[model samples]
Target: MTAAAIGASFRPNELEVRPDGSGNLLGSLCRSCGAHFFPIREACAGCLSEDLKTVRFATEGTLYTYTIVRQSTPAFEVPYALGYVDLPEGVRIMGQITGVEFSDISIGMPMVLVLEPFGTSEAGDALTGYRFRPADVTSD
Candidate 1:
């Protein structure tokens, strides 16, 4: 891993990382129907219009559902909380849950996007990814 690889976004197309350590999740906003989609779409799903634009999604959302995975591939550690959060833009995003006990998490709880070290690359370079945390919880 090279020094430049540190703090790099795991998926640059979906996430934008700033030099000041602030970042946002990228998505597409449909100009015709006022809809938003993750992974940035080329056309509007709601109105079937090609008039769409890239936009930064809101960081806050509501917890929709979750589960704790006890087993997975070697790249991921077991017993991590995974959940879908419904953002204000009307998109549900899947991400890991952190900063709170698994038992304490509940549906409808407010969550906020948090950027952290996701994992290493094939070359052992550090990568930045995102997780959802309880909105009331402050970072250390």
Candidate 2:
């Protein structure tokens, strides 16, 4: 299968699933200015660097801020937590917070990245996406 074929049904970025069926999301790291971007970028926003290397991000981060989305959107489910995560590599990402109740969410909480089904593309293929879950639940 082609890269588009596999990534078509999943997230915006190409994902690699290990033999254990664990997902590892891929992103681009700017080789020139050391900037990292999720969903990948053709050029670095900091230095306008065109040389980017693909990298797999660590599946852990710290919650920066969040909001309990009570209203449903076309692409997201209602009562979900959406927030920015401060990755260890110094890049901040906006994503959903899963595996926890909305009442339990707070700033500076520990989180782990996980792949989830977001919605669909324009062509109607299921679009898998990434989210951050409370680290406490996966700490065992």
Candidate 3:
């Protein structure tokens, strides 16, 4: 890692990147209803319970669906693949698809989270962010 990368930190909300390059998505787990939510809610929507705890979601998920995005805001580049990945904890996460050709992505392929430099801070510091990538595996 470069010196800038070593000093990078994730933006508050969905990501929690560690210094060791091992991190997970931030979410809320409801102790009452056993439900998980992304973006860390203070209360559980499932059971309307306030007994929620902040938790880190799993890094791996299965691509539930995808699309080729030809239009987006200026901050993002065009013609990117976007998808909703189904995590093991029952939360569906939306991220920019990466590490594979658009034609190769499928509805059920295994995916893993990977952190990259998303942008820079106002003070010109690197900001870490995440995206989903193709899982390492071989076909039978």
Per-candidate local distance difference test: 0.91, 0.76, 0.85
lDDT of 2 at 30: 95
- Please give the TM-score that candidate 1 achieves against the real structure: 0.93
Clashes of each: 0, 1, 0
Clashes of 2: 1
Stretches of model 2 off by over 4 angstroms after superposition = 1-9, 12-19, 120-127
Error of 1 at 41 (Å): 0.7
Worst 10 residues of 2 by lDDT: 1-10
Once superposed on the true structure, which residue ranges of model 1 sit more than 4 Å away at CA?
Answer: 1-6
Best by TM-score: 1
TM-score-best of 1 and 3: 1
Residue pairs with backbone atoms closer than 3 Å in model 1 (clashes): none
Expressed as tens digits, the lDDT of each residue in 28-120 for candidate 2 is: 899998988876789999899899998988888899999988898675557778899988877788888889878888999999987655567
Selected candidate, larger lDDT, 1 vs 2: 1
- Winner on TM-score between 1 and 2 is 1
**lDDT for model 1:** 0.91
lDDT by residue for model 1 (19-118), tens = 6666899999998989999989998878899999999999999999999999999989999999999999999999999999999999999999998889
Error of 3 at 43 (Å): 1.0
Q: Per-residue lDDT tens digits of candidate 3, residues 1-58? A: 6443553555667888787766789999999999999889988888899999999999
Cα lDDT for residue 86, model 2? Answer: 88
